[model samples]
Target: MHIADLQRLITRDPGRPRLTWYGDDGERVELSGAVLHNWVNKTVNLLVEEFDAAPGTRVLLDLPPHWRAVVWALATWRTGATLVLPPTTEGSAVVGQEQDRGVADVDVVVTSHPTSWTGTSAQLVAVPLPALARRFDGDLPPGTIDAGSAVMTYGDQIGWVEEIDPTAIAVEPALRHEDLVTWALACTPRPTASEPRTLVGEDHPLVVLRRTLQALSLDGSVIVTSVASTTAFADEPERLDRLRATERITD
Candidate 1:
């Protein structure tokens, strides 16, 4: 359901906004269903054409609660690669616990902070979180790909598709393609997914990721916060209220 579900959502309503992101730096980006599908396709091409990612490939996602993270998730799934999400930002319980794990531990490292991966063999794809940016913010390491720019050059339509087994593991935490939507729905509790729900929240990174997937699977929209809402909105009540009203974040 991972790839097929996304295709259906984009086809059903190409112009409806699917993802609305809110960054800690006051950045906001809204991608319609078609736009979201394009990003996923381009990233899928980037992974398959540039990085040679395919089934059984393990791609590590080292990112915060951002829109690109969602894009990477869909793209990784589209390629039938295992999405390796470290339980903790540093390192935690992965399927195979390595003695010393860094960003280099996986086949590809998708992150904004690539400095942590020194002398690593994995393909580093540096991503800039800003809404409008051509490349990653500073000097990226020698071999790192500037994802912001590289993704733009890729074809908007997915050129090829891999035959994904419904039972194959698509994510690190042992989520299979057949059960991905069911698992995500369990993590995110909000308005029924059948309607146009615009959910906003501050949850764990994994939970937030799951929530985004749930929204996509169920034809809903999501607004994720870069920082926990409590922290980012602590000093700005009016800002919070305005956003809630604008996005129709009703309980």
Candidate 2:
């Protein structure tokens, strides 16, 4: 089961909201399957046309656990590029630091920063968050690409791309396409027709990725919150009431 296959499955239900994200600052973002797929397609075209990304290409995903991160991950997988995550140190809450040396191993690095980055020798792709705000205030660095601006010019559909191998390495830490599909299927709970199954969790890559996959696998929707927000809403009764009042969460 390649990432492309999962995307195809979700795209069949284009009208339903597949992912809803809430930022720490009360920013709300909702993407239907078709919208998500359109972003993925643009990303694929950006990586391929600009960075010459192809099968076996290594892409360093240096972004936060925002919705755009999920878009990059799926785009990388769909392009058959190996997604290399930044190294994590034990007991450290921060991830995807710019100073990390892991970027040396990849061909291109995609980051969620407003300005250009000079931390790595690899080609840079700055993917600004918030989606709507101005990307950069000054001139971008040489050899750096602004994904936010470039993606808009690309076609919304991925046309004439090569077929991706399901056995290819999709992510670092030894996760393959087939493995991800199996895991998502196993973790996805059966959803009722009345309400969509929902998951709330901290804005960390691992948590966001897993929950997003599970929701997509079961044709459900998710609500993403920051760690601080999760801590603030820890009381069980209040949390339960809030979830119930929303009338959108099944789990």
Candidate 3:
């Protein structure tokens, strides 16, 4: 299945919560299919209009498992741009590999922290992690795009989509655009689970992205905790239990 196909399925129940996030600072946010789509659409416009991203364009997502990070993934696929996560960031925690050697061909870098843009020549798009943030209040690096705030200015509906090669790599770990949905669906929950409501405690953005895909594949939902709050639910068994019960988690 393709990204558009998954999007159609999501909108089938637009109001049903698709992803729920808990931040380190005691912040909580929920995204239904409709809401998620809106964010993704806005981001798609940003990538396409700002950078002319399309098939073969490589965008490096350098943020953690925040809601904006999720939107980046969705938008990248929609644009048919290659989402070059750092091999480990590319593959690990934030789904990106770090350093100049790692991102040799990256055309754009979307990051929350741009310590020094000198490390890479890729266009920088700085994002703030806060859910309600109207903009990135921090001092932005030279030639940086405050995407967190610019996202609001972009048209919510995607202006267009590129027709990409189905065989082209859409995500890392060699996931092709055509095979992504099937790959995600293959990540089935345990046999006893039904309408799986997954709990992703890990802080890795790759883990969050993978779980999100798995939940969608299973026609399930997910509850994710941010990097700072990984231990929030774990430290309180009672609270975790209450959360599970409230969300009706099957696995």
Candidate 4:
């Protein structure tokens, strides 16, 4: 099934918030189901009609952790396009990996940090989130196409680019237990995803505190901190400061 076709779920609940982007500046951006559907549609149009990107095209994504990255990824999937997520920051390591892995001809590169890729000599294009946002301005684009149709249209558009044979890209589909725990900690309490506190087990505050200390053991600066919470969690600001002041991480 075309995963991008998931847009159809929006019609059933147009008002439900489909995406919530928490900014580093303490700003929150919420996109309702209907709004997200429209943004993806416009994104698809721009990719196909403007950039000539289509299904099977290998697009590279080099973006920071933000809402725009989420939208761009989904939009690429919607177009049946293969996506390459480079390391968070650009450097020789990222370039060497893409080359060693034979991922040349990266059609596009969406990035917020442009200087990181200077002198890479790749066909890289910068597609920043703010710029893409200006394309729609919290409004829907003109189109009567449904989710399934969009995927088919995208597939056809890519077919004209080159006589490219269809092939599956290698990807690891499973996450290790520790990796899963790390991922779970990054999540906040939300309806769409798991509850963060659910991972807080037996030791109550102590377990979390110990885990936080363990997380710091690897990298002294690696600290667990909370944003907004009424409950007394181990990673609270006060505890983090105490740990830091005591040189718990320095050692």
Q: Best candidate, lDDT-wise?
A: 3
TM-score list, all predictions: 0.88, 0.82, 0.89, 0.52
Best-to-worst ranking by TM-score: 3, 1, 2, 4
What is the per-residue lDDT of model 3 for residues 1-251, given as tens digits with 9 covering 90 to 100? 66677777777889988888888777889999888878888898999998998988888888888777878988888888887666443322322334544566778988887654445667889888886687887877688899867988888677877786788888864878887767666654432465578877676677677778777656677788786677777788898888889877767
Off by over 4 Å in 3: 87-100, 188-194
Query: How much does candidate 4 score in TM-score?
Result: 0.52
lDDT values for all models? 0.76, 0.70, 0.76, 0.43
Model 3: per-residue Cα lDDT at residue 249: 71
Q: Give the winner by lDDT: 1 or 3.
A: 3
lDDT of 3: 0.76
Tens-place lDDT digits, model 2, residues 1-251: 56777788778989778777666555668888898889899989888888777777888777777888888888887888888876553212222354454444578878765243464557878777763543543556676778767888899988666577667677775777668766655654544543355756655586677767767766666666555556655655686468546637777
How many Å off is the CA of 212 in candidate 1? 1.0
Alpha-carbon runs more than 4 Å astray in model 4: 88-98, 119-123, 129-251
| Candidate 2, residue 203: lDDT | 51
lDDT of 1 by residue, 172-239 (tens): 65778788888876763655536445555555556677877766666778877777554667678897
- Candidate 4 all-Cα RMSD: 13.1
Superposed Cα deviation of residue 125, candidate 2 (Å):
1.0
Mind giving the per-residue lDDT tens digits that candidate 4 earns over 44-98? 6656664566554666666544445555655665565666666444444566576
